[model samples]
Target: MSIVQETPIYRFGDFTLDVTNRELRLGEKRLELNARYFDALALLVREHGRLVAKERFFEEVWADVVVSDSALTQGIKAIRRVLGDDAANPRFIQTVPRHGYRFIAGVSTVARDDTAPLPDGEAAGSPDAASTPATPAAGEAFPSPTRLADRGAAALATALATALAGTLGGAVAGLFGGLLYGFGLAHAPPDPQPGTASILLVLITLSGFLGTMGGFGVGAGIAAAEYAAGGRAAWRIAGAVLGGMLVGGSVKLLGVDAFNLLFGRTPAGITGGMEGAALGLAVGLGAHLGGGFEASPWWRPVAAAAATGAACGVLIVLAGGHLLGGSLDLLARSFAESRLQLDAIGHFFGEVRFGPTTRMVLAAIEGLLFASCVVGALVAARRPRNGLPA
Candidate 1:
């Protein structure tokens, strides 16, 4: 019998681990994973189905960083979920009471040509000491230790780009909205309080618009990161947006109540909680459905716009009953008693009612914002420099 050394590529069950690309593919679909989890997986595979101790994982994976055993537990759970393995009757990974884990599945080293073309434009340099002898398919090459670092860099870059794109989009929207209201272009306020009215309105409008833009952009950035990490773009977008809204809403509710209790002043309207929950549901559904247009380059933007507009309508109606027939008495009362200086507070409080034209404009703004989010996400998700292995 001849001894075969370890290889960068491994095939076990229906999964293919392209260590070079740092990806785990099931046939054609690529599974999403974090860098740390992948590192732990690669270590286990390298050990050739042998038991990997918890202490060893900490030394290698964590590298002096203090963490609890739960981190490892979570990583194992994530691996199982991706591999569709059950803890009770495990197939791939089996836990040893309190000792460690063992890779029970059979692993085969994939033959490869180290001199083949690298995916990320790296030169097909000489193979290192770890190179194993084998005949791999065309375009397959062994991944170096630097592959993990490169993947991490790519993730960071994507996040930064998404955040920048979102900030720019929000700033533009704020400038436009602020100019319109500041110059007396929009509906005039009910009680224009002297020389400070326009300045106050512009500042307040810019602040609120910027806040909304920032929040949505952060959500979109999260979705963009998810897509960059090989997740389904549509589902990620919807999930990220909905999750962000719900969280933000919850914090807002608690913060408002806390502030009111501390200072004896209401910070939010009565329907604020309802508005957040409802808006979260509506926006999430809209993003989820609009993601279907991803295949069509032209219709994708249109879908995003439509979804945004719909979400906006729902939000407006939920917030203060501006779109449909609903009472705004609570909102009005909150505004009257609250000390907060908000832009167009009268309109929100039902003092300056929104006509059909005003409502349509608001909806259009929402649509534009949604479209901007799509653009931001796509911009960050541009063809990755180091694409998945062929």
Candidate 2:
């Protein structure tokens, strides 16, 4: 009689590497990896804590398939990126110069029965069953209730984190905008009745409120998209656009109604659904291009987000979409007795009044600040803390 060996399932950090299923999962999320990359990872994991020489990888992982040294390097790099590990400050993997590599993280193992009873359609000893892949069918992937609950909890946590990041970013952007508008109004030719300090506080408060609303909408959409599609670029962009449009349209409609009811007038050319959608599209595209949620060396995603935001801001201005500054200017113009005036601020942009140049410049600044902060905060939120899952 032959004795069958149980398959080993390795658990390290928050990841589970199931040898039997040939799957790698981080928390409840299944990471997508190439077949060879998966094999390379499996090899490193199987020989955890010990050096895996280059020759051994070629022999075992790339057996009968000739490849260059760069292939191994790229595989390792891809692994690091997926694991969110830094080459300079290695966490899960460590290089042993040109000799070999080691899986430095502590790992635990569990045994899975290979001889377990087959499902109804297949017989255990049949040729078809023997040739069948180990991967679970779509419907059978999450067979346990506990797993579904865990995934739900994880998604909720991620949504909240991204929302918070957006709020923080919006607040920062608002603060900067408030400073510019407040100071400009205070120093206007009319002798500054409200005082710089008072104006600054009011403007800052208003800007912060608007920013918070916008940021939350955008951030929540991103989280939802990521959860639903799992790194698909198109899905993420769609989510962003949907989220931004919903929030922007609702806010604009409400704001206009409120003003019309209170003062029998409404501000025109203010930021609305179209503007929000454009910004959202830009942000989503930037994040996707920058390596989307799981990117390592964190700065790449953040910088990309900022750059895209700046460009979008410029486009919004050129397309006659009003951002916070322009919207505020419109609001001030809507009321004859309104104390708020941004005309004096245009002097900085070489204009006699708050002009297109000033609006465009401020919009760019706002976009850069908002995107960088949101992406940066999200990245920080996703980072593992004290060796624990993020």
Candidate 3:
């Protein structure tokens, strides 16, 4: 009979241990595991889903050394810790008293390419290694590991580029609104968390995404078409969307207090801070997304805004009434309080009819922001260096 050595490749849950290279990975982080502990893990994975006697372990793992029971126990503990395996209720390595260990866990197997030295040498190169091996289709790996790294680096660079594009685009799209407000294109309170900065932010961000997708779609689609997945454009668009949302909300917080002092009037400390934050996020997102000025509740863009605006209106009416007069007139005064926040721009579009002055102002501001966002997104999308996987 021929002896076939299992090349120390095993996976269970969100983990993989390469015995040959003495490496381990949990999620994405690779660990520098002790040799003995690594050996123990390797043995367990090789005989996964079966009982492995303790004597067999001693013979196979500790053939040269005469180690005490404590040494073995320590090694086992170290292995458990590295694997995040619980002794009480083992998730990876199972314990059996007066016997040995068993790895009764579900594991997906992949044949190691023995032609080359196990590519786990460099810790820094682990992510690139991990990403390449899991391609959706089985065909062939690229030219070299360097090529793979280049692809990953490109992907990350693209992500950052998209973020920057959204920020720049969002600013441009919202120039009109900012000018109208006499704040020179300011977002809500700059001290804020993530999300859209205002209705303009949302519209601009969305429009930018759409425009960039249309402009970049041809190139991205061409790139993606080369691969098995038929959604490169979609992925780029998704990145733009995510990047716009994340960047837009954060970037606008740079001068929120200044904007508040000049054009924003909310000054109630924490409450006002939160309001400013919400407004900033709303505006940032709307500006970056760069969609149309939609106010119809049924429309996806307008509907999303209306839902948020409605909730804000309801909360404001109730909270305002509670804070001011305690009359609980939420139903009656919801609209009056809601039409002023950065988000109210959506609610005022086509969905809710208001006085001429208010509607006209809202329309002009949204139209201006929307135009800028679309232009920015198109500029980004049209650029060839957009983050597309090679």
Candidate 4:
């Protein structure tokens, strides 16, 4: 006489892990998982609340095949993505640093007899009674104050991280722009000027400062919007625009006041709120169209960002607004004794001065670089903690 084994179904949170059918489901939706990933998830759920060592995975999940540790890491990342779980603050799968993983969520199991007949009004092979959606158990439906506090803390942490990423990205863009402008001015036709090195250093430092400020404003705005609106795209774009305008306008106002107080003159037609808003709009739209940073193959979002930035840059120049490059040119012209000569850059484009054509060309380049850098940094910052592709 042969004894039959009962199939065990694991229920945790809104997910169901079926051992016999080899399926994972969130409510009625069946999540997509490869054969190996499914096995890995099952292993974690089976050993719920207990650490499953690296050697155990090799023995149980990959017994037939020889694979490296990265394979397991990638599999875990995939599972996390599908489950909408964060490795940093895991509600389901917890990483034990180099040791292995443990499933921390509260799990309940029910065994079913495959050979048993289905009850009336229930189809065969349908979800078992225990698997059906029901009131969320305990802390899920009505969270304790501690759970709410934890969520708020996590959100704040995520926002800060995003803002920091944007700041770094902007600083990089500024450094690049400063170098381009500095080199062009340094190599002007008359000869390399004595103060060219100092000018270069000043430009780099000033540009980097401006970039950092702009990036912080935009990043903080987007993060706040995401938190408040729960990731609505429209709200996010609006946040970006508002944030850019606030930072740009404030900076321009303070700059004008400072110059007037010291030099008794103010530079007009410099980059300000209008330019910031336009760039922010481009970024928000490009990010939306790119389907977010987690998109596969990676280039889709980056290309979209570059295209939008270029278009916005051209439009800003045409509309009589200015970006960093054009604004600096305006400042130089406002002061006759200023050593910042951008004429060489114009000469490269067949213009004797920093003409309209040159401004447009430079604007486009600046926009492209700024958008690409910011978006790339954002993606890099938001990747899974395990450093795997989402």
Which is the leading candidate under lDDT?
4
Global lDDT of each candidate: 0.50, 0.71, 0.41, 0.73
lDDT tens readout by residue for model 3, 1-390? 986555535566667666656668876689866665576667676666567776555545543332223345656777788777799998777888867788766654456763232334423224333333222111111235665565456544443443444445444534443444323113334322234347346444433443232223222222232122211233433433343333333333533465467656423211222322222233223322323121111133333333333343234333431111111112124335542333322233433323333333443344334423433343434233211111
| Clash pairs (backbone) in predicted model 1 | 111-136, 112-136
Per-residue alpha-carbon lDDT of candidate 1 for residues 1-390, written as tens digits (9 for 90 to 100): 976543457666667677767988887799997676787777666664578888667546654232335457767777888889999998789998777788776665554454233343221112221143334332223434575466456556655554555445445544554554444323456554345555647445643454354445444544453534333344555544554455445655765687578767653343233433333344344444443222223344345545664666555654453311121223334556533233353364354543444544554454354444444343333323212111
Per-residue C-alpha lDDT of model 4 across residues 140-178, encoded as one tens digit per residue: 334577766666676677677777877787778888888
Between prediction 2 and prediction 4, the one with superior TM-score is: 4
Using TM-score as the yardstick, the better of models 2 and 3 is: 2
Residue lDDT tens for model 2, 119-187: 544442233433422332233223366655655676566667766876676667667767767776777
Task: Output the TM-score of candidate 3.
Answer: 0.28
Q: Model 3, poorest ten-residue lDDT window?
A: 321-330
